[model samples]
Target: MGDEWRAGGFGLYIHWPFCEAKCPYCDFNSHVRDAIDEPRWRAAL
Candidate 1:
């Protein structure tokens, strides 16, 4: 046996996809004046 293996690692990325109601200092991949339905977004996750 070589180097021991540790537990599996996992990551979760959540995108807001909306920023039209706030300031304009954000540099992320956000959108503006876009309608986001919750049920439709849940299906995407």
Candidate 2:
């Protein structure tokens, strides 16, 4: 088990919660938006 994660087992994720449309099978916490506050969102990230 030692150093197991070093073998390409880790990932980096950035969750942007806004989308133009919602897909039927996506299990993400997201929203459908016609517009977004981009500057505010960038600052939050």
Candidate 3:
């Protein structure tokens, strides 16, 4: 248990639900549109 990588058990994970490309394998949660209305989406959220 003397691994240098394991000395500090600190990690970070970020989840961004937005995608610019539409993947066939992915659900409709992500979209790839030419224009995105940030103000509308922000207000809806």
lDDT of each: 0.66, 0.89, 0.66
lDDT of 3 by residue, 1-45 (tens): 356557776565554356788778986566567677878877776
After superposition on all CA atoms, what RMSD does each candidate show versus the true structure? 5.3, 2.6, 7.0
lDDT of 1: 0.66
Ranking by lDDT: 2, 1, 3
- Write one digit per residue (lDDT tens) for candidate 1, span 1-45: 233333335445787777666556766777676666869878988
* TM-score, candidate number 1: 0.46
- Which clashing pairs does model 1 show? none
Candidate with the greatest lDDT versus the true structure: 2
Worst 10 residues of 3 by lDDT: 9-18
Q: All candidates' TM-scores?
A: 0.46, 0.69, 0.41
Clashes of each: 0, 0, 0
**Candidate 1: segments with Cα more than 4 A from true spot:** 1-11
TM-score of model 3 vs. true structure: 0.41
